[model samples]
Target: MKNSQLYIITLVVLTFLGCKELEPRRPKEHSTTNFYKEVIEQNKKLNALETKRIKQTLDRDTLTTYQSSANGFWYTYINKDTVSSQTPIKGDIVTVKYNVTGLQGNQFYDYQTRDYTVDKEDFVPGLTEGIKLMKKGETITFVIPSYRAYGVTGDGSRIGINQTLRSTLTLIEIKKPNNETK
Candidate 1:
């Protein structure tokens, strides 16, 4: 699977989790009882299905399974070149300029505030993880899955479910949101 394709799959999970669907017996918090267990099982099957779909649809002969960390809400990768480590942590305010696109190459979120929230539960899982992996003046690309994004219900017109998302993220700057000093 290509990174781009992997990104889409992750977005699906992200969006699915982000969706606040109200179930009759569902609690206020995100519902795990409704379909998460089944959903996870389905996701495993779907992942395989997606891998096949991508390889067949794109006619990719040299496709490799693109992998993302399954443990955390967020993950990061240093550019193949950069060496230093100044990893981002929770509560770190950051400024980023990004362009989110889909498989057909549709534009989504354009650059706005670099100091956006790094909240895991707010945005999709892939995005929440992809952004915090940068330093001042750094750019990275992400291929997020729908599950990790807006899921099937999606967030109005801004995002769609089961649709893979592509992003070229540039970390403009990193600063504390409320704190004035170190």
Candidate 2:
């Protein structure tokens, strides 16, 4: 009887241990919500710092008056075509000669001439809007923020990540769409 009782107790203990509740395995890492929130906060801080730096640069420049664009960039005309009222429309092909420089005026790209179909081609985001603001024979120097210029990933060549750019653009010609006669 003693042996049977001891065996029964051991069996009961083993059964209980073996029937332990199974739980779903959880990841050791943090939740995605927390990670996204951290990314947003970091981006906010970066944007603020970049904006402050841009403002400081603008403050020091007394030679040119920069006009703030509604699209979140600043521009000053190098050569304004006051006589011509026409600007590039959505489908108009525009020929431009432009050069890119850093905020401190270090050249990233030399003067290159390219023809772009306005609002229809892949070009610099800020400059796309900047082009529409120009008439033929107008030259404008645009100060673009990093987010509007290249965002986190840059042009993958000379421009680095989160680098703001100053581009001097000359609108060489604005060719109207074939549907519209000159």
In order, candidate lDDTs are: 0.63, 0.92
Candidate 1 least-lDDT 10 residues: 72-81
C-alpha-based local distance difference test score of model 2: 0.92
124, model 1: CA deviation in Å? 2.8
- What does each candidate score in C-alpha RMSD? 24.1, 2.8
Winning model by lDDT: 2
Clashing pairs in 2: none
lDDT tens digits, residue span 1-182, model 2:
99999999999999999999988998798789998999999998998899899989998999989999999789999999889889999999889999999999999999999999999999989999999999989999999999899988999999999999999999998888784522
Tens-digit lDDT track of model 1 for 1-182: 69999999999999998897866875567666767788788888876665455445334423433335452222233343266556456777666777777755788777555556567337656778876666666766666656676767877888876776766677766666575321
Give TM-scores for every candidate, taking all chains together and pairing residue i with residue i: 0.59, 0.87
RMSD of 1: 24.1
Best by TM-score: 2
95: Cα error in model 1, Å: 0.3
